[model samples]
Target: MKRLHLICLLLAVCCQEITAQYRVAVIGSSTAGGTGAWPLDSAWVRRFNYHYKHQLGIVDSTYTLAVGGYPVYKGMPGSYVPPPDRDGPDHNNNVTKANAVLASLPVPANAIVFVNYPSNKYEQYSIAEIMFCLQTIYDSVLKAGHRCYIITTQPRTGGPFDDPAVKRKLAVIKDSTIQRFGVANTINFYDGLYNPADSSILAKYNSGDGIHYNNAGHRELFERVLAKNVFATPLPVKLTKFIGNYSNASIALQWTAECTDPNTSFTLQRSTDGRNFENITVLKAKGLRSSLYEFTDRQPSPGKNFYRLRISETASLVMSNVILVKNPQEGLQVKGLYPNPVNQPDLEAELLSAQTYSGIVTVLNTAGMSFYRKETNFEKGLNKLIVPVQFLPHGQFILCIRYGDGNSILRTFSK
Candidate 1:
């Protein structure tokens, strides 16, 4: 009888280990950073973490990489440099950095990521720009092999946020965020907190500063996140490795999966802009406990190629981590422009060079009129050229770079 009891106990332990909770990472601004909530413990993120660990009967870990008064720009990738007027990325709070940190842990692959930036950039950035930033962050999170939940913009009172036009724009942003990420993947932070009359934070939920929420409001936010039931679905497969190598005019991709179901299917997808992906090929799982897959792309995009795998099981679908393979040639090449749809005074161009060469960078108008020109030298490997566009009129312009070897590149940007 004791031996049978011991066997049952071991089985119970194994089941507990298999059913471990999800690891969560939150990248957000002041609200998520616990700014408005008095005593901090009442903050939504903290409350969520507490409920997950205590009420849920499991020790799910939650990591918050939020900073006070930070906008979407500050939470961008570390390599991303904001336009001249904006602040650069904060590595500690950046979404890319947070993803990396979470990935290094020995946790389940289906980590939960929360992106909450509420009304931080309403005055400084246009709705389009704000959407772009949010989309970039969301894509990055998805590419990192995690589930992302974007929190909608909450209402803010006083200052410029009270303007009817600004409120309308904020509403547009909130709706756009939901429409873009889908309702299932978004946490509604604006529903009960905002007053319908003026679109400002309700008095009961306001933290008295008019910008953030109090303990009651934070509780409401926590409730919204809980209502999503993001943790209900169980991950069907585990992707152990997803990597790529570039060589001999072709790129080779390989990935390994563990504990995959026999009905699983893998769809190899490629992207040039990292936002829109096109399917390359699809393969069925080998119906093994562990499996390895490989593919090669003979004709990769000239510059950077982004690759990811969509693993579809009978009940669950997930994406592998995005791998970037640069296909560089022997001459001067213009990679791309940063902060596209330029709003700041200065625009930066990323260039890759095989050998040291002198280059002339020029900004030309639509009618071929030279608006700005600069003569600069590019060293071998990657180079960045900053083109001043403050003087250029508000319109679309072309950037042309003429190398000493007679190789020229042309790219377009907007002011």
Candidate 2:
């Protein structure tokens, strides 16, 4: 049986490698799991997948399971009571509501299950309850035969934050469990991104509204968490403008370029109210080459529009500025994504030129999902994978894929 299991694992991996595809997921609570790839397109998960394709040369079939108002294991401990007006009738219960949302999805192949273990609720419950919830989620994922990643929940409770208490509490749960189990998969969300003193990266990531990010906040989140490839590099790009498409359901954009990298293309993102944005789509360019280029955001909606082009490091340590999508909902730019976006799977690129290459992709969210999977030879170019969108509720996302030579590319799209 062990041999058979090993063989199955090998086969599963082989199929993905050959196709260069993936079906990944993001799971957790509100800020960490909020809908729309805030820093990216609709959610960080989707953005992670896109970055995978652009930089690491992988495709993505991504899903997100983060929801806005649900806490983890409410009866346990530190869980806070959302304002009665905000939480509505059944806001008190925690995982019960989240589980209902998760239960509806088609679990993906080689699923990446991210759970916010021992959240603020752990503060209220005894260590035992916190441990029980942790074990339950772990065992459940193991039983389902999926790979589980345990990231210490982000700093939830920075004072005057949405719930500084909640953030601090979750941090405690993360540290305690890591010490007890000595689990290698455990992550460091605080040092990696949050303000150590405040314990509320969410507040920093959020706008003065105390809920979402301003342009500055969004950019910070992108810089800290966005994964970069160690091998691949993007060609030089100069985006000239970003404007809303009032006539069409899209945004209008243009750019100029020169380069030495293997692939050349532009990934566009849009936002409502200017603070949060979604990876609308990607515009492909014939690779191992360059020239001036122009594109449009045909997916314009009836609202304020924010636009940006993820400028790849055509050389090194080089990035670009954000352009506005003046009129959203204009053209055929992919818009209004579902619970899980980034429909493309991982891809493996074959540069006609002898350029360094990489294929590492990571999916993340505000719910504290971090790290990417290192995959080689995922599939030939353009292979597709059907992934579950059960990571979090509908929201913003990004796909950050790093190459083999210390270069990364980002693509934002919506879920």
Per residue, candidate 2 scores C-alpha lDDT tens digits across 1-415 of 9999999999987876665343444555554453323454544444455665555554344455555644444322123343443322233333333333334334433444555432434445555556666555555555555545555544444333446566656657666777754554454444434543444455546455444444444344434334222223343554444443445454556565554455545666665434344577776654544455566655454335566666544323333455544432211112223333444343222222112232455555545465244443223233222233445345555555554333454544455
Give the runs in model 1 whose Cα sits over 4 Å from its true position. 1-19, 105-108, 233-415
Which has the greatest TM-score? Answer: 1
CA lDDT, every prediction? 0.80, 0.46
Clashes of each: 0, 129
For candidate 1, write residues 115-225 as lDDT tens digits: 998888677798887888888888888888878899999888777887888887877888899898898888778765666556788899899988989999898787667
CA RMSD per model (angstroms): 16.9, 24.1
Could you tell me every candidate's TM-score relative to the true structure? 0.52, 0.39
Write down the worst ten-residue block by lDDT for model 1: 101-110
